[model samples]
Target: MKVKIYGEGAEAQELLDKVNNSLEDLGLSDFMEVEVTMDEELKNSLSISKTPALIIEEEAIDFRDTIFEGIVPSDEEVKSMFISIIGGGGESSGGCSSGSCGTCSTGCH
Candidate 1:
């Protein structure tokens, strides 16, 4: 799948790096590609109107909300984020594969 992340600033690089690492760690690196776009007109066309806007496959997965607020997604959210960014092809293990949410309060907590 092809994913594009838009965010112009010092943190832009950092966020991209983290995202890439996450994908790689999950063994999805070989199937995905990430790009950092910095076209102002393109940004406007996407209705981003803000920095740190992400366009994943013609859809705006993330915009200013995450950028300005400095809110990182929960690990599960990040895993599910695969759908928005990538087109999706792998079969999930059903339960949380990351196990990063051992303290999650959804039900097991």
Candidate 2:
């Protein structure tokens, strides 16, 4: 699994630390690879409009999704998201299995 955190500045750093701690506490620090980026081009390519966005990329499949944006998510939320993604089963927040119901901003469909 590959995780990307996009942002620059103090708030971004804080979020990064929180995410890292959560990953460690969840015992995912060894299995997952993380990258913190401040590249404007990469952020624009991902259409990340807010700072401290968390993107998860699954290596077993051609799947990449943004699970968090803007506000920081709780440790449990982070763990749940990872579990769902890794397990390949979860209800979509957009009410569409494909995640393209026009309600989700991640553009997963």
Candidate 3:
């Protein structure tokens, strides 16, 4: 899977960090590639009218989807979105039985 984050400035960087953290927490950092692009032409091509848009692509299935337009999603939301896209069972196996462990809750698992 490929994840692309589009935006500029501090907000973009913060969102990028959140995405990275979430991916790492989910143990998917090694399996996925992430890219951040602020090219206006690229954004135009994607028809993204807002900054901080996240685009996910799965080459094997020729699937391309976009989310988080104009708003930064929470860490859990981002993780869940990716999990759903990859068709994972979405059950975290870490020590967060209540789904609220410190690491998991802070998106730093």
Candidate 4:
């Protein structure tokens, strides 16, 4: 999954915890691979230009503030979102591989 949230501080850490707790409560915690930080090297490597950004498996999620504005995606919601994302032909967005089963792969996102 390789999830990275680009930012650090009490607020950022709090948001990270919220994300973890929310996901875990729904039993979808394993669906995510989370890393919290705002290191310059990490920002550059992840191509992040804004704080509070999220990179999911090499794909840029776009908004930095939006993700941490106290909003989190539900498991089914996340799944549906990625379905559209991958179907649009944008790097699979951590979904299934065509060679593996020709369908969404066990909700790898």
Each prediction's TM-score against the native?
0.55, 0.69, 0.75, 0.45
Candidate 1 overall Cα lDDT vs. reference?
Answer: 0.52
lDDT digits (tens) for residues 1-109 of candidate 4: 4556667676566556655664576555686677776578756764655555544553455433222222333444444434443364354444332223234323222
RMSD of each: 7.4, 5.3, 6.8, 9.8
**Candidate 4 backbone collisions, by pair:** none
- Give lDDT tens digits, candidate 1, residues 1-109: 4556677576666657666877876778887778888877667666665555444453345332122223334444455555333435353443222333242333210
Off by over 4 Å in 3: 90-109
Consecutive 10-residue window with the lowest summed lDDT within model 4: 63-72
Model 3 lDDT on a 0 to 1 scale? 0.72
**How many angstroms is residue 86 displaced in model 3 relative to the true structure, after the best TM-score fit?**
1.9
Judged by lDDT, which candidate is best?
3
- Candidate 2: tens digits of C-alpha lDDT, residues 38-105: 77876777788887888777768878766677766655555555555545335445332344334333
For model 1, what is the error of residue 75's alpha carbon versus the real structure, in angstroms, after optimal superposition?
5.1
Q: 1-109, model 3: which lDDT tens digit per residue?
A: 8888898888788888988998898899999999899878768877898888887778898876665677777777776666655557545543332334333333321
Q: Tell me the lDDT of candidate 4.
A: 0.49
After aligning candidate 1 to the native by TM-score, how far in Å is the CA of 97 from where it should be? Answer: 19
